[model samples]
Target: MTTHPTGTREDWLKARLDLLKAEKELTRRSDEMAQRRQALPWVKVDKAYRFETEDGPATLADLFRGRSQLLVYHYMFGPDYTAGCATCSTIADGFNGFAVHLAHHGVMLSAVSRAPLAKIQAYKKRMGWTFPWASSSGGDFNFDFNVSFTEAQQRDGGIEYNYQREPAWTAQGIGDTMTKRGEGPVAENADMTGTDVATYTRERPGMSAFVREDGVVYHTYSAFARGLDGLWGMYQWLDRAPLGRNESGTWWRRHDEYERQA
Candidate 1:
């Protein structure tokens, strides 16, 4: 016998109707939140940052690619890692499908990582992805964005992420902070990426948005951690399923990792 509860069609209809009301309320709240997000003031970017792209060296503004807006995915491919983060890769797998649509709508979407361009190129080819991936190797772009941390920052617990400073380490433990997260995901993802825990923990996944107007680039907004839940296309689909996310742990892998089974 199935463990799931069985119910009559009428019962399901009554329950679903109640859920529908809440869902509609959530939809209204979501629309209001989006408007508030767009109302945020844009901060002008005056720093001279550079990135290595397939077309050659490019500046932050150049990433616009003639579009008025730019969306950058802060891919967690640290300089020392042998592979990109599986979680980030899973998120990126959906990018290729919608990237062109966004481009046509006057937005340029790209990924930035700290790995060397050659390493990034090799991996991108392995994944069969064509989206524009740029290398920030030897640049302060990642550091300035607070997505990448230094060794000292890790040791001292001085990293600031999600616009807040992480708690200092005490004899009790790493205090109330989401940065460390847990050893399970951290160690598992680190081993998958072929790097030590420290190396993997130094990098985190994030996304940033910028707009260019009147020849000035302005940093519009950024999201990290759970803030990026909306962008994970797989989760968006899974959420509608009967079981929802149906997740317990790190149950995903790089897209290519599953190819052999097919």
Candidate 2:
């Protein structure tokens, strides 16, 4: 028979201890970032932003629906677009649980996109998500938050009426504004600026938050594709074999080999 190491038990225990330490470090970092996010500058919502609530036809202020704090996730779902972002849908799938917990914290959270009410509702059903997903059919909110693109700008690549360009982490609510929300001459949108608080939405990250004295709610974030790896825990599907694969720790699977079939 082959002989084993004299102190393999100690080695395994040491490895486990190291894993615990790393997990604690990650928790500490998250706490630190949360505090920093709270301290970040916040822009003011000057004009009354509009949204289609579950009750139908509501103003931006109405998004809170009575709560003081609000969190608006600018999911990508424009009228011209075919499907809502798959990655964002995954995040929403997980968000269903958080939606209830957030209310207990006195913080309200909802998702908005530029798609029509009917389309958005249909997509929500297809994904089986019960979270507060709403439509932003009439407003510059999507473009302002960098989720939706302009006609001319979308056609930059020569594809007419397409929203293709996906830029890396653009600044929050910084872009060209259409005439009265796509009616007049284009100019740099400076309406959602002013507070020391600046917010942004782009790739390579997963979600953002804003806090305030009266309560913080802002239109400035989107979680996409790999942008949501760090913020996980909902999917029991991830309990299979190792998620991080190869030399890159970024790859992961949602299910085990045997359970993948059913």
Candidate 3:
């Protein structure tokens, strides 16, 4: 580090060196991320959560099927809730295409929700996703991980994280929103419909890598529902161009402002 000599030979040399150093730092960071990506965390699962797979009753371990690495997208499909979540849909659009090379890397991806198999299947067909999907209806898995919630809890109040429930208290902070009600256990102002910034607020769904040795399937790690956002980075390439395919590229208006492609 040197003082501002102002336009001397030293300044030019220092500037060039700074650029090179920045480039190297960026490269180093990228390399570090690559290592972390390869270093998938292993988790131990003891709870036997229930789910509806393409077949029948499925345990949490059943999700992994035969793959060593599993990824589950937390889809929004509460049974009584008819429409899929808009934000979830946007994320799904980003996930339209797969590289087909994930399996070679030993990662299998799927989507899961609390909806019935029929509902999940219908949405998958509408979205044109070939990715695997499952339903969690029997247990509190959705509520447990904070993906879905009961109307009383969601309306009366609760924040669904990962897949568990946290009562909405209101010290006016993280776990204290309900305290703002100035009444009792639940807050009056506490919103039933969740906040706007909760785009990524859903818990990271579970992704587990199971290893079976001596006839026992041990739990490795089950990932979050929302952590799959990066798989569709290819969508970023579209923003470079202009509005093609009738405003598909335009952020000027919302999805509803125009009609669906008929």
lDDT of 3 by residue, 1-262 (tens): 6563558798889997998898899889979976775576544555677888777878766666665656666766556545455445556664446524654566666677776888888767766677667887667766655555444444344665544556543234334442332332122111221322122223233333454434344544344444543443434454334442233222222134246532
Deviation of model 2 at 214, angstroms? 5.4
Count clashing residue pairs per candidate.
0, 9, 28
Off by over 4 Å in 3: 1-27, 30-41, 94-96, 150-229, 232-235, 238-262
Question: Which candidate, 1 or 2, has the higher TM-score?
Answer: 1
- Stretches off by above 4 angstroms in model 1 are 168-182, 259-262
lDDT tens readout by residue for model 1, 1-262? 9888889999999999999999999999999998988899999998999999999999999999999999999999999999999999999999999999999999999999999999999999999999999999999999989899997887797889888777654433334243244456666788889997767878888999999999999998899989999999999999999899898667788987877635
Cα-based RMSD of candidate 2 = 11.7
Report the Cα lDDT for residue 154, model 3.
Answer: 40
**TM-score of each predicted structure versus truth:** 0.93, 0.64, 0.57
Encode model 2's per-residue lDDT on 171-216: one tens digit a residue: 2222223123322211111111111111211111124343344654
